[model samples]
Target: MLYWLIKHVLLGPVLRIFFRPEIEGKENIPAEGGVLLASNHLAVSDSFFLPLMVPRRVTFPAKIEYFTEPGIKGRLKKAFFTGVGQIPIDRSGASAAQAALDTGVRLLREGNLMGIYPEGTRSPDGRLYRGKTGIARIALQAGVPVVPIAMFGTDKANPIGSKMWRPTKIRIKVGEPLDFSRYSGLDGDRFIERSITDEIMYALMELSGQEYVDMYAAKAKEQAQPLPDRLPESRAS
Candidate 1:
């Protein structure tokens, strides 16, 4: 398969040789069975590097656009992502949240590991943001343990808005699996979901040592951008 070829034969060796990626607490990841890997969103490379360093294949639900773009480049891009274990999910409409849960639950129920970014988007300034509760819901619904992970130096290796990769070393720290079975049958409770999500985020904050922001990453990005200048009223006369 292309995934095996690229990881073992093509790209994996090249990356290990240059970047020297390191991982701590690798043993925390179970050798088998289903798990939900909840990590902070840093650079786009977080998706690539985290999976690259882990022994087990980690699959994330990527935006549907990654596989739907037109033209040759798009096709190749889609192929590469799919080969790398990215699944496409439609992130539109009112049911997008449920749709994502369905996709993740199916994978977990089938005894597969699933990677998720609870922030829903990349952090704008490397500060940890409030985690979305969808991940919590998925874990509860699937009865899987949530493994909190934190990736460092990935932003420097493949920074935001950069089209090329750098040689910065990447490090990953994995926390012990969090079991929320005590809150069983409470998947539909928003309060329980929020508590679970906050607990996972706290674990990530401890691992990554990043400043915690209570707002969503997308909202923080919007707040960081300057607003457009407004025209003075011309009809005052």
Candidate 2:
């Protein structure tokens, strides 16, 4: 099968030999049923590397732009992402966020393992930012447990906005699954959402050893936006 070939034959050996990622607490992942692996996003590689180490097929909802384009280039890109098992969701507006969570809920309801970046965006300074309530909403509504995952040193392994990368030690720490069963009676209420997000962030803090900020990841990203982050200045600047 292509899955095994990619995991065990190709990417598996190459990643183990080159990056030398140190994965701890993998046992925290549930062996069966629907589970969420909520983590911090530090680099683009976070998406690929995290899933590679996991034994189960961990799926994430990638932006629809990954599949949308005109021509052969677009088709090839779409096929590649599809082959890797990433679900495409239109992330355009308020509805975009909702659609991702909606899709994730459906996957959970089907007893699948879903991976999400609670911080939402890569932390600009590597410090853990506040997680969005969306993660909590997904867990509570879907009635599944969330496992806190902390990925460290990935940005250094493949720093953002760089065309070249260096081999560096990467660490992935999977904390214990968080039980939101107490909110089983609350359903989709705001109170339960906040509680779930807080618990997830706390676990990430312990694992990643980063200072925690109380603001949402998006807001933190806005504050840390680079000069090129403007219409004029950019990473190339």
| Number of the predicted model whose TM-score against the real structure is largest | 1
Q: Rate the local accuracy (lDDT) of all candidates.
A: 0.91, 0.84
Instruction: List the candidates' TM-scores in order.
Output: 0.97, 0.90
Model 2 is weakest, by summed lDDT over 10 consecutive residues, at 228-237
Residue 154, candidate 2: C-alpha displacement in angstroms = 0.8
- RMSD (Cα, Å) for all candidates, in order, is 1.0, 5.3
Q: Write the per-residue lDDT of candidate 2 for residues 1-237, one digit (tens) a residue.
A: 665676678667887788898789899899999999998888877877888888888888888889997799999888767766688988789988888889999999999999998888888778898888888888888989999898987899888788876788888989999888888867568777877788888888988899998887678667766665436555674
Q: Which pairs in model 2 have colliding backbones?
A: 228-233, 228-234
How does model 2 fare in lDDT? 0.84
In order of listing, the candidates' clash counts read: 0, 2
